[model samples]
Target: MKILWIDDEIDLLKPFIYLLQQEGYEVETATSGEDGVELARREVFDLIFLDEIMPGVDGLEVLRKIKNENSQQIVVMVTKSEEEDLMKKAYGSWVDDYITKPFSFNQLLSVLNRTLKRRSIISEQMAEEYATQFRTFSEPADYLEWVDYYKSIVSWDLRLLDYGSNDLKVLQKEKKHEANAGFAKYIENNYRDFLNGKGPTLSNNLFAYAVLPVLKEGPVHFVLFDSMRLDQYYKLSNSLREFFEINTEFYYSILPTATPYSRNSLFSGLLPLEILQKFPQYWSFEEKGQNRFEKELFAELLKKHNLRIKYSYYKLSSIQDIERSINSIVNDKADIVITVINFFDLLLHSIPGRGDMKGVLDDERVLLNLLGYWFPLSPIFEIFKRLSKKQRRIILTTDHGFIRVRKPTIIYGGRSISPNLRYKYGPALRVDNKTALLLNNPGDISLPYEDPSVRFAIAKEDYYFIYPTKPTEYEKEFKFTFQHGGISMEEMILPYAIMNPR
Candidate 1:
């Protein structure tokens, strides 16, 4: 490992340098910040040790310049003074490690071992450990243990953060798919029982079970991002730590992880059959701009419970809309706010299948990185950032998650059917053993249908339903794009998180 030590008192660090060299590290020493900057620009360094008190150029300025050159350069600040402001500045500049003046030589060695081995020498052991643990992840005792399976997958994903796209991580993705196959079967068997409160939380009961009762305590801000996966939430959770203490849990999405079902169920606190029976005018099949009655559904739920409070609901589609409405709506006196942000779902649909998306959003990790980057820069992020100052209780979650569809399965259906690519519903739907579930009658699973002959078929694993008429054309369009409304871990398992002000 190549390490650079920049200190005005270069003679004082000779013992530390000798120890590091004996430990098989190449050490380069600089007597001044100017010399250090020149050396850093000239050569690559695995790590940099910076002195807080310097003569000509101070430590903060050197830290700024080094970060300006390479933002990801690992820096450690060694300081004698215990000024809170100075330590904060060092930390804000992305210092990887910090040490006090009187810290033991062994302490410095411990820091070095932790920081350096994360990049090298630990991959073999981590891979072997994951290989053994993969067997445990593959088996689940029941439907509840499926949540544990999802947690295990998230654990593996977290461990692979510093090391992206390694072979072990790749194998973990396959194992995740394997685990999802098991979860799909589990949901097929006991989804209805769970909906009746048998096991893990489901999408239909989120409002009644999780949100409304919590609202009895204080005002809450609920933000829903459509079509965001559980793994994607983990990617974005690290960023939330700066503003709030996040508490996350897993829940299963209702079948047909699509918006009209899962999102509507969330707002109404009832299944589709119940919604159709209660408010017949609310149900509409508008695909692109569906769930138009969510505001009404929220109102109905509040009124059903005979509770009254100030609240606001928004379904924001554009960044401009978010910017325009956020200021006015947040300023209003309200006990609760529900905002449905549509950027993540839209990006998934519009990006993939375009010829230029080969390197941009070709897989799960790349697409997730793109989406996670957008979350912090989003106007909603800025709004929540302002809310954080007020110590508002913010609930961050999604209506449903999405799965990347790989294999194409043929489905023979009627002239007009449900437009979801992952599943199809119509009268006399002809589909066989490749189904996640075959609902012979829609009412049995709480699905709404005017005709009793109408049945539903959801795709299993990574399959997307392709029509017999245009097999090749449909394959060209949506062979590997992210989709929901089906059965899979990424689609059904959800991240339900709450952020309390820190």
Candidate 2:
């Protein structure tokens, strides 16, 4: 790739240029910012390394000019001043990276290489690496250990995604789809055992294992944001690392990874049916009103566990609520604080409602882009930092993750059937028997029974449920909308992280 280096001390940087050239990079030099801008305009260099201090048209001015000309150009600020205020000013001008003066040639080369080679290196290297191991672990018969393999593949996929390598991303996606197909077969065979408590930790066992121990340590703050996919979790988890050492673990969300059930089960520490039976008052199957509180099941869980500490539960549905929650936490010292932010979940559901969002988050890559823009600046993160300052232990997790629905499956159900693209809850619902995890007895899975004949069915993989009455219409409407409550790694695998103030 071509790199343009602009510096008044360009002659002194001969060693750096030679090292980069030896590394196979096209090194172009300009003695002044004006010359650098001319070269940039004349040629399409991949990146520009501009010195902050220059005789005429200083780095900041040059940066402003470059951005005005082509905002997409990648520019790194090289500065002799290590002053915090100057660094901040350079960053504020939108430079990709800042390099201090007197830096080693190796460090300079490393930064340049990372910036230019991130995509190519990750794409080619990761694809080749995963391809070899893919064969060794592709067997469907080895279901017992598939979870780890699946997680490994997902971890790589997320890594490549972060690396922003489109080619490797596509390759990893295809591989992951292949793994998911095999995983579907495995789940079909073993799901019954898992739900029946004859196997590993499924949805029912997630909270008991993940949350209870943390609670015992001190106070446990569980933030169960809905529809937080694993990749998004990876992005947000990076921020938490500053204050919390993450002991990351995953659990399989029950078939329907949707909020009403999956999130309820997570907070209540009981399956859907058990929640209804245990807390009928809080459990509402009503079509209208905030079905979220379904019951004050969370409060009951703490009570049942005999874990008594001052705790607060806040649901942030609006920007105002988020600000308020952050403001409140800044002053108070609650033992535990559980805040559920619905922005991601709302974003998913709203994708179908709003044409713009649907167009933006059309795929996983786009979805991650959207997430990267929002999560770090999110009110939850702001509150987290404030809480960290108070030296409080924190646990940030999600109810379930989301998947971009591609294939649509038509199902015939009565008018009484609940209309959810990822899952269906009604009697006389007709679906492909093999494609869904059908819960004939909701009671067994601890899900509430809406009717005496009510049953729950969740779509698997990238599939979403559509009614036969308006098959084509619904298919067109919900094709690319993000939905949950199905069986896929994105939906089922949940993230649990514990953090203590650094």
Candidate 3:
């Protein structure tokens, strides 16, 4: 790593610099703080050693300038002074570490080891831990163990993304896929029973399990960003950390993991079949513009819970709709505000169909950059910024997440089959059984279907179903684009967070 040291007593520090260089650090020296400040601005250094009480520009001032250039840059204050005021000033300037003068090589080495090399050390340890623990989660875990396994992998993925090497990241990703493969099997075995309240909190149980408890604290703004995955939430959480203390967990979206099913289940607090039976007016399964009935369903949920609460529900799709909604939000007030933002979901669909944005659909880094660019323009971001100032409890979640489809499983189905890339249903549906779940009866899993002859084929892992009629066209369109509505960990698992003002 690159190192820069600034001190007026350069002669005395020659031994230390020579030692660092011998130990494989590229060390540079500046005799004055002014020179050091300019050098830091001109070049990139992994670590900086700034002398306190230096001539011209002073150490504290130089430290401030360096921090202004790059807040995350690691800078250690090396000084003879133990004075409280000077040390406080150094700390205030974002000094990453400290070392006193009249110290030996061991002391300096200790500081360097802890401060400069910390990320690499931590990354190595974490990668080793994951390697060691891989086998425990490699086998099929039961429901609770599966969640715990997913949690471990998610945590490791987030950390490894920050510090691990490319090779380690690949290993972690492979382990993740292994876990997902096992999870798909687990879901196929129990998903039908799970929809009947056999397991933990589900999409249908969200309002009762998550919403009411959050509402008891204060006013709430619930944002459901459709097709948002866990990796996406890491960036979002960082952006929001400055405004809110975040509490995070997740719930499993019922299959098929699509907006029409999972989102409806979330708002209605009932499975699709139950929603249809209990409130026919609010049930508009897979119909165009069906999300328009969400407010009515939400109202029905409040009444069913005997909640005497006021709420404002909005399903924002167009820019004009968002403008109006923002205006209404700024002017009016409600106890609960629910907004379903669909840009990510739209992005996922548009990518495979439209070539302009296709390059980002399969690359995680590019996709994250696109998201970073889009967040500033997003109405949900504005809502978060506005609500941060108010005493509001904010919730950011999604109906379902998505996965990039790599393997295309060929199938044959009638024209009545659902057009979702990850799933299809019809009497003629046929495919290799091991690639996905082929349900002969929709009602067996509590899913809604009009015809008795219709069956379901939901893709698992990275597979997407393709019809034999349009092989070339389907292959060209959706080879690596993100899609949901299947039983992979990405689609089934979702992020649920409660944000309190910081």
Candidate 1's residue-wise lDDT over 287-371, tens digit each? Answer: 6655989999888888877888988998888778888988865665589988888957455544436664765447555565555
TM-score of each: 0.79, 0.75, 0.76
Kindly give the stretch of ten consecutive residues in candidate 2 with the minimal lDDT sum.
Answer: 345-354
Backbone clashes in model 2: 14
> Could you tell me the lDDT of residue 51 within candidate 1?
92
Give the alpha-carbon lDDT of every model.
0.78, 0.72, 0.79
lDDT of 3 by residue, 90-198 (tens): 8988898899988999999999889967656766787688777874544645677776777777767656644678998888878877777888888988886777778
lDDT of 2 by residue, 149-256 (tens): 766876786666434356766777787777766777777777767777766666556667876777677765667676677767776675466566777776777766
Ranking by lDDT: 3, 1, 2
Q: Given candidate 2, what's the lDDT at residue 207? A: 61
**RMSD after CA superposition, every candidate:** 7.2, 8.4, 7.1
TM-score: the better of candidates 1 and 3: 1
User: What order do you get sorting by TM-score, best first?
Assistant: 1, 3, 2
